[model samples]
Target: MFCRILRRPGVLLNQASARSLNRAIFTRSYPFLHGGPSIDKKTAQKITVNWLYHDGKTRPVSAYVGQTLLQVAHAHKIELEGACEGVCACSTCHTIFTDPVYDSLPYPSEDEEDMLDLAYGLEPTSRLGCQVTLTEEMDGVEVRIPQATRNFYVDGHVPQPH
Candidate 1:
């Protein structure tokens, strides 16, 4: 009886279906939850970035090529918080691209779209810092960090770590 049940083909199909359902449910319920991007330090180089603070202050720093904006900000002691640790998960790292640089970067991903939708001050050229990688073309990028972030669920409760 045990062998027969183990060999049942429907069991495998049911398990696969359940896994797919779980993924869809989780993605929909928590849009700002995701894994980090693959990092290759070999591609690391130096670049320049200008950060505009919420209080009308701007600062320039040397950032590493291929490093996400969130990483550079954190390393330079900027006032930005990557609540999701550069995983493109939380909108806590939401930033606005200013002028010429905004038109140079690639478009945002679907997951980024979902998180940006929940950001406090969504703009036409807003992007998650974790999703934007530094490139040669983006040498002099200008990013603006908002004063506060809306780090809560739709129910007005902060998300708890699992």
Candidate 2:
């Protein structure tokens, strides 16, 4: 059913109701289905993210309110991995925030902290990407992705999107 729909332009699975599609794609029902929160250009809140990569490359991307860091990275095709998806089961989505923004975000949850322990290059500002949701106050945030990620549990393989 999905394949047939994909073969057509501007179509979705017939079994997928409007509400279901909105929930699954636009909202957080399945985090993997969406890279970031739905943004309405007119009234949408915008946040600027400076992503520092392992290659010493920096990319700036826009983030919408309520979207997680992992969402923005994935949306922008940055190389951070969400090995456990985005439920914080693993630290493959580890990220670090620059000083001001680092101090700006709320303290990490126990689950996030636990996962960070498994992340590579853990630092004082280290955080699980999936756990850092954007807010109005975080308009000019800067996050850095570690040079390498350890996903030994996933056999060291980072799955790519289809």
Candidate with maximal TM-score: 2
In model 2, residue pairs whose N, Cα or C atoms come closer than 3 Å (at least 3 residues apart or on different chains), thus clashing, are: none
Per residue, candidate 2 scores C-alpha lDDT tens digits across 46-101 of 88888888778888898788778877777787788887667666788889877778
Q: Mark the regions of model 2 whose C-alpha exceeds 4 Å error after superposition.
A: 1-42, 152-162
Tens-place lDDT per residue, model 1, 12-126, is 5343334333433444433234434444656667779999988899899988777788878877877666665655556888899875677778888766777677688888989
lDDT, candidate 1, residue 124?
A: 90
Q: For each candidate, how many residue pairs have backbone atoms clashing (under 3 Å)?
A: 0, 0
**What is the TM-score (0 to 1) of candidate 1?**
0.67
Clashes of 2: 0
TM-score of 2: 0.69
The residue-level lDDT of candidate 2 at 5 comes to 50
User: Which candidate comes out best when scored by lDDT?
Assistant: 2
